[model samples]
Target chain A: MKLIGYFRSGASYRVRIALNVKGIKVEHAFRHLRKGEQKSDDYLKINPQGLVPSLLLDDGTVLTQSIAIMEWLDETHPQPPLLPKDPVNRAKVRAFALAVSCDIHPVQNLGPLNKLAAFGIDQANVTRWAKEVNFDGLQACEALIAAEKGPFCFGDTPTMADICLVPQLVNARRFGADISGFKRILEAEAACLKLPAFADAVPEKQPDAE
Target chain B: MKLIGYFRSGASYRVRIALNVKGIKVEHAFRHLRKGEQKSDDYLKINPQGLVPSLLLDDGTVLTQSIAIMEWLDETHPQPPLLPKDPVNRAKVRAFALAVSCDIHPVQNLGPLNKLAAFGIDQANVTRWAKEVNFDGLQACEALIAAEKGPFCFGDTPTMADICLVPQLVNARRFGADISGFKRILEAEAACLKLPAFADAVPEKQPDAE
Candidate 1:
């Protein structure tokens, strides 16, 4: 398997943590997103959305969408399961992941932020836009996970929710979003950082980190 | 079972189609999004994200996120399966769904569009922003499903991909996007509309539609 990704992409970061936690080794390929490499014809053929973190299987099948790829990985490799056994619990975990993936990340993504520039949003204000968006969603995420017993998002062990949360928190901080009020999230992030899977998948630790 | 949603929300529309297709008779509850009912204290207790299309199970377990709720419904009721049995195909269907859910819808959602006002975009430009974003995504979705044997998005059957596609196309047309070039998509939409599941889930057909 091979993974094509950019170092700073939170979606790619989610997959990297999942691969490490599942102990699945795949070759790495870089798409320097800031340089517009991902939109090139070669990469577009691999992922028509021109997004990062597409997983290429040995069978030549390519999987886009980080959540789908992570779910595929969990299904194909059962150990260190990313989802719980019960259906409802699985839905809860997925909802948590989607809260970040759908509500937070996509709105604050580089594509949308760049689009804001066309609306005459200057650089500093663009960062503010990203941070404010991240803040609102992460607050909801904090409340969602508050009732769960967690060293991670759901329990003592990390699941897909934690995999998604860690990277998103990293992104929130990068944009100068004040996360001090999200105690449960901070606790979960600290617990996840204790694991090599989470720690090693940090953006600065990736091979293509600028 | 019950579902809480607004009439015209694309995410809500996806779950309604799934319930109808699966033959599950869940009670319906409407939250008038334009009136800010979804963010009511009562509703937020059920869903921290306060997004529509939350499924309330008989066990009183609330399921949020349209895809997660649909997957749970599919898992609990296997008849007329929404996804294929093969992992690769399932991933394919999911990727198609996320191409719209993650890439297009959230960025153009009311929350983000309202935020654009703070960035000094007027109502006409806001509509233009939403339409342009929808156009770009639907075009990619058109290319992604082009190779498939699709009266629906995948094969002849209306899998999760079609479930997502139909509503997104509805939204695109509402936003005045020129979707004439997406031949395959229009064909799939026509095929899906022939089914009562798809036809009945249209925005105008909903009980809460204005």
Candidate 2:
């Protein structure tokens, strides 16, 4: 498999963590997102959505969407499972993941942020917008997992929830979202980063990092 | 089971379609999204995210996030499966679903649009923002499924992809995103709506549509 990604992309960071957890080795490729290489024709053929973290399989099948790729990876490589075995627990884990993937990430993504700038929302407000988005979404995420006893989002081990949460917290901090109030989330992030899998997947550690 | 949802919420509508597809009947409740009823203290207790389409199970287990709920539903009641049996095919179906759920719908959701307005983007530009989000997202969705010989998004049966697609099209048209050029998407929409599961779940048909 050849994993196509950008260093700073939360979605790409997600797949990298999953790959590391499963101890799977795959070829790596980079798309310079800041330069808009992901929107190029060649990249579009691999992922029509022009997003990074597309997994190109040895059989030549390309998989897009980080959550879907992670699901497929979990299914195909079940060791150190990223999700719990029970139906309800799986839903909880997935819900937590989506809290980051669907709710938090997309609004502050490069595409929408750039669109805001194009509409002449000044850089300050655009930055404010990203900060607010991160803060608000992370607040909800913090509350969602408040009941769980966790060094991780769900339990002692890292699941998909923590996989998603770690990267998003990285993003939240980048936008200066002031996530200091999110104790549970910060605790989970600390637990995750202690492991080589999560530590190694940080944006700065990736081969594509500028 | 009880489903707490607003009729016009795309996330809620996706679950409604999934429920109808699975032939599961549940008690229905509404949170008037426009009135901010979903953010009520009582509602937030059920869902910390305070989002719609939360499925409350019989034992008082509340499941949030429509995609996760749908996956749980598929797992617990797997007669007419929402995902294909094959891992690769399942990935394909899920990627298509995420294209709408993660990429398209959230950007144009009430929260972000209202935030844009608060940032002093005029109402007309807010509408334009929604329109472009729909148009760009649907265009990519169209391309994502271009290779399929689909009456549905995959082969014959309606998978999670079709469930996600139909609601997003409703949202896209609501925003006046001109989808006339998206041939494959339109075809898939036509195929999906022909089924009562999809048609009956339309916002206008729901009890709280007003």
Candidate 3:
């Protein structure tokens, strides 16, 4: 398998953590998103969406969308399962991930942020836009996990929820979002970061980190 | 199962189609999104994210996120599956679905459009913001399925990809997006709409549509 990604992409970071957790060794490649490499003809042929973290399977199948890829990994490599077996619990974990993936991340992504700038919004306001979206969404995530006894998002071991949460929190802090009030989320992040799978996938630790 | 939703919500519309496709007899309830009912304390307790549609299981478990709910239905029901059985095909379908779910729909959602308004973007400009995002993302979606032989997005059968596509196209048309160039997508949508499962879930056919 081979993974094409950018160092700072949270979606790519989530997949890196999953690959490490599943202990799947794959070749790595990079697309410098800031430099417009991902939108080049070669990269677009690999992922029509022009997004990072497209995984090329040995059979020559390419997978895009980080959550979909994570679930595929869990199904194919079941050890250290990224999701619980029960259907309802699995939905809960997925909902938490989507709370970030669907509701939060898309609004704050570089594409939309750049679009906001094109609309005549200044850089300072663009940063504020991203942080506000992060703050609201992360607050909801915090509430979702507030009552759980967690070394992770769900329980002692990391699941897909934790995998997604860790990267989102990294983005949240990077944008200077005030997340101090999200105690449960902070606790889960602290716990997940202790694992090498999560630690080693940090943006600065990636092979293409600038 | 009971589903709490607003009739025009693309997210809710996706789940409604999935339930219809899976032949699950879930009771329906409505939250008037324009009226701010989804943000009510009662609804918030059910889904802290305060989003529709939230599915209430027979066991009293609440499931949020349209994709998550659709997957749970597929897991529990099994027959007339919403996804392909093969992992690669499944990822392809899911990636297509997430192209709309994660990228397009969220950015054009009522919440974000309202946020753009709060930023002093006039109503016309806000509408332009939504139309532009929808046009670009749906164009990418068009590219993803352009080569497939589709009565649906995959093969003849409707998978999660078509489920997601139909609602998104509805929103695209509603926003005056020029979808004429997306021949494959339009063909897929027309084919899916001919089925009772997709037809019955149309927003105008729902009880709460106003």
Top candidate (DockQ) = 2
What does DockQ come to for candidate 1? 0.82
Whole-model lDDT per candidate: 0.91, 0.93, 0.91
Candidate 1 residue-wise lDDT, A77-180, digit = tens = 98999999888999999999998998999999989999989878899999999999999999999999999997788998899999989989878999999999
- Give me the runs in candidate 1 sitting further than 4 Å from their true place: none
Per-prediction DockQ comes to 0.82, 0.92, 0.86
Q: Among all windows of ten consecutive residues in candidate 3 chain A, which has the lowest summed lDDT? A: A144-153
Error of 1 at A96 (Å): 0.6
TM for candidate 1 is 0.98
Q: Write out the backbone clash pairs for model 1.
A: none
Worst lDDT 10-window in candidate 3 chain B: B142-151
Model 1, first chain, TM-score of 0.98
TM-score of chain B of 2: 0.99
Candidate 3 residues lying further than 4 Å off, grouped into runs, are: none
Ranking by lDDT: 2, 3, 1
